[model samples]
Target: MRRGVRTEEMQEQERSKSGLLLRGRLAKELGQHDEAAKLFGEAAALEEALAQAYAAQGISEQVWRHEFSAAGCWFQAGNFLRSLELCDKLMATPDAPETLRERARSYAQTLRERRDRLWTELLQSEHTLVAA
Candidate 1:
């Protein structure tokens, strides 16, 4: 109930949100897709909680980063089909920005191509090994 306590809580909450986003970004950069996805999911959850808090406080913009995190998770996991589906869904969602949608689309396309090429190479390698 103390004013100083409330201020401290708000600051701590902001720091927590920022920390989650930073951790997720770092994980993704390190090519730790599984870890990145978990971090992103955690970040998204925190953002959703913050959004709900804002809504309760009568704020218009409930800024949640779930879509971006989810899209990144799918892309990082090499689940190109899922990534594409999510990208399309996010594109249609009013809360998702056009820039985010475009980013998702780009990532989805890249993942799909990469997955296809990798599979083809793997098959060829297996065939060669069998013959040998």
Candidate 2:
């Protein structure tokens, strides 16, 4: 019974995660950037929570996978710093899977290359935030 319940919970969370990602993409495609960002952030939070649940169960692979997803969400939301943080966390983990570390390294490199453009966007948003 406990196992069944856990499976159900995981399935439900996966469904929700998928929905959020789809909705975020749609919003982005529709030019609703702020809405897309918010949706992506929500997706990231959900992924992080799921990662914690997996960690509590000693599911190392799932934990890193979820963290990788959360990083992607942060990237979609233009939260470069947060995305990079997750990538760094994965890369720094001695016990992390080799594939995960390699992926993170690749992602970190891309993030570095886009840093200037992302920084400009951040500065613009900052001004808008300050004005409002």
Candidate 3:
């Protein structure tokens, strides 16, 4: 096998981030949305833990990258609030890269709008029920 090629032994050794992401993408392509989301959520959580560890070690680039990745995975999993929370934190990090900060800002807006829309729809449905 080539240097970077994955082997069976490597696969059996751990549920690594790349493996989880690959599995999640496979599940998504199989139309198993919930399963894919679950896998993505797990990936997101793992990324978050990595980010926290990097942060503790004062590695700004790795921390920002992992945080952004975790936020993206949460978004894929439809966990908007968690994604938005991480995005917001990234946006607020003064030392984080501008590109990532810009992306986070954009994600935050979309997440906020989505959250507000859900709340508004729920309220409207309740009002309709009460009126009826």
Candidate 4:
């Protein structure tokens, strides 16, 4: 295969991941949470596979972004733990951008705080309801 053709093929595969990621984002924006979650999960798997493949070729920011977006989709869907795992993975990689690392840190902190507060409120409300 010509080098150019091979590069095109790789890019095409990369784009398939991106397409699914975009579909998930769009579906979520349209209030189709279930569809969005399914698409996001598929996109996440594809992005993860692509990231590993590209890592073997060389560290590439584009591949990292695919993984980032997949995780971000989960974050947007309130899957904080999964998103935190992805963020931690990205942040630990030497290839990740400083900005991305910082953002991931910020997001992880926010998610932790938010989930805690939400649970606290829920517990308090439940306690009150039980007493009533």
User: Could you say which candidate leads in lDDT?
Assistant: 2
List TM-scores for all candidates, in order: 0.50, 0.82, 0.75, 0.71
The whole-model C-alpha lDDT of candidate 2 against the native structure comes to: 0.89
* Alpha carbon lDDT of each predicted model: 0.61, 0.89, 0.82, 0.74
Candidate 1, residues 1-132: lDDT per residue as tens digits? 111222455456657867876887898899887887776666555554554455455442333244445455555544566556666765666655677767766766776788899999999999999999
* Clash count in backbone of candidate 4: 0
Candidate ordering by lDDT (highest first) = 2, 3, 4, 1
Residue-by-residue lDDT tens digits, candidate 3, 1-132: 112333454334235877889999999999999999999999898888777666666666777888888998998898988998999999888877898899899888988898899889999999999999
lDDT for model 3 comes to 0.82
Q: List the residue pairs that clash in candidate 1.
A: none
Lowest lDDT block of 10, candidate 2: 1-10
What TM-score quantifies how close candidate 1 is to the native fold? Answer: 0.50
Off by over 4 Å in 3: 1-15, 115-132
Q: In candidate 2, what are the lDDT values of residues 1-132, reduced to their tens digit?
A: 012124567768878999999999999999999999999999998898888777777778888999999999999988999999999999999999898899999998999889987788999999999999
After superposition of all CA atoms, the RMSD between model 3 and the true structure is 6.3
